[model samples]
Target: MTRFAQAVAESTRSVPVPRRPDTGRTRVTWRQRLGRDRVLVLVALPGIASLVLFHYLPLLGNVIAFKDYVPYIGILESEWVGLANFAVIVNGDPLFLNALGNTVIITLLQVLVVFPAPIALALLLNSLMSERIKRVVQSVLYLPHFLSWVIVVAIFQYMLGDAGLLNNFMRDYDLGTVSIIGNPEAFKALVTGQVLWKDAGWATILFLAALARIDNTLYEASAVDGAGRARQLWHVTLPGLRSLIILLLILRLGDSLSVGFEQIVLQRETYGADAAEVLDTYVYYNGILAGEWGSSAAVGMVKGLVGLLLVLGANKLAHRFGERGIYQS
Candidate 1:
């Protein structure tokens, strides 16, 4: 072999080999993850504990619905009574029936009338150019949400009670007094109005956040296409809010049966059980007050089951229309 050929071969052999980069992600073990994020895990422990204690732990007590629950006998020792407790509801106990009817009425009224109020209020607030005025209005509206049901009910009683502000004003003008507070006929309307006044502003916070997330370019583009404010809102704003609205609607339907325990309980005595009774109040009165634990548990279990079905049904409908509901299908 020639010396030049040997030299060329040797040079080629000395050329560096390209190395593959170590870019692969290492799999994390659960233990390692727990250790690495120990602080965060510790922070979340209270919430996890709360759910286990207040939510999941109570699920075990639901078996009392199928048993003749005697406090002395305790939960596990309670004699199994099959479906006897539920038969009270199915066989039409007058008190249970009255409570169920009132619950349905109040739930429907709140869902249909009060539910849409927040979205409308958010839209109205969004339309205002002045941030200061909007904030002031929001502060005023949101204040009521922080107030307890007791306080809200008290305020309503002061303003609308037979001998309160409204009646006092009527008397001064020699006008006839209106019977509003404790009036059975207007109980549903009063409850719905109270809910609106208390929570509508707070509910608007979610809607307003959704509104803020809507791209401004869409609004500008709509305007460029000669669309007016109404048209822009119809085409751009509503579509942007469609998902959030549907999600909230599904959630609301799930919770429709849970009208208001505190509010209803406070009013039940004044209005009489026949007038203001709802499922929650009925459960409380029967379980805690009357010691009919099994029957109350049965009613509560049925309510929860119905709520679950409503959420699932609504989510299914949402998916059928090619939209993501509460979760992915």
Candidate 2:
């Protein structure tokens, strides 16, 4: 044997081996922990099963976008139409173009104006001195978020509809009454306003959370350095929330095509299709009402694909600016 092997053998012969302690207790503890985890998974099984059955399973229906889908014929019997549906949406459908334009306009308007309002509101609330006043303001703000869209729309109607509150008050005072709801020219503005009223407070929750997580020491340091409130907000608060702001912005970009689906559908008749027909509304009208399933599915598929690309692009852009996007690097 080699010198190292001889040394190891001599060491082994001189040393007494110690007996291993019983591991049955440790094994039983591990078994108990595993049993608890299994029970937790069992409790979550219904939700997991529902998502698989309803959400993921229904994804198979998207195949209809590529076929001449007929309800009575079923998916297997339907003739393959290849790219015909997509071609019609791109080259032949005037209404599709109109709806696309409206969706883009609304998305842009909301992203620029409405999206920032919650962040601003949250910052203002975070700066408040009195806890009671802050709590009251938050409660009032969050109340609107829980209101149904139908109720919100009805409230808008009561305030802005012809011979409604504002118009009647204007007439009684001999002031000019403005058409706000049914006016095609103001439809974008009205939708943005509705969004602001309904969800601005709710959206503030995320920003407020982000603001709360910021280091108070940074603010104190800024104050010692002779920075004013505005300066601290701009330099310290905003910088701290930058990653969260970018993440939220990327999510909004992914959902750009989905702007104002139910809202547009509800008001389409009032403003006419030309003014209120967003992609989702267009899909509903054409697919469900007109029985053009393939065409509508094609539109939806396109929107989903484009949205996916936008999110990917935005995430990449965020990383280029030295920030982690929704996903980590």
Best by lDDT: 1
Off by over 4 Å in 1: 1-24
C-alpha TM-scores of all predictions:
0.91, 0.88
Residue-level lDDT of model 1, residues 1-329, one tens digit each, is 99999999999889844444574556567898999999999999999999999999999999999999999879889899999999878999999999999999999999888999999999999989999999999999999999999999999999999879999999999998999898899899999999999999999999999999999999899899999998998999999999999999999999989999999888888888898999999899889899999999999999999999999999999999888999987
Task: Give residue 17's lDDT in candidate 2 (0 to 100).
Answer: 58
Residue pairs in clash, model 1: none
Cα lDDT, model 1, residue 89: 84
- The predictions' CA RMSDs to the true structure, in order, are 5.6, 6.4
Q: Model 1's lDDT to the true fold?
A: 0.93
Q: Encode model 2's per-residue lDDT on 19-62: one tens digit a residue.
A: 44775333346676778799788888999999999999988899
* Model 2 residue 210 CA deviation in Å: 1.1
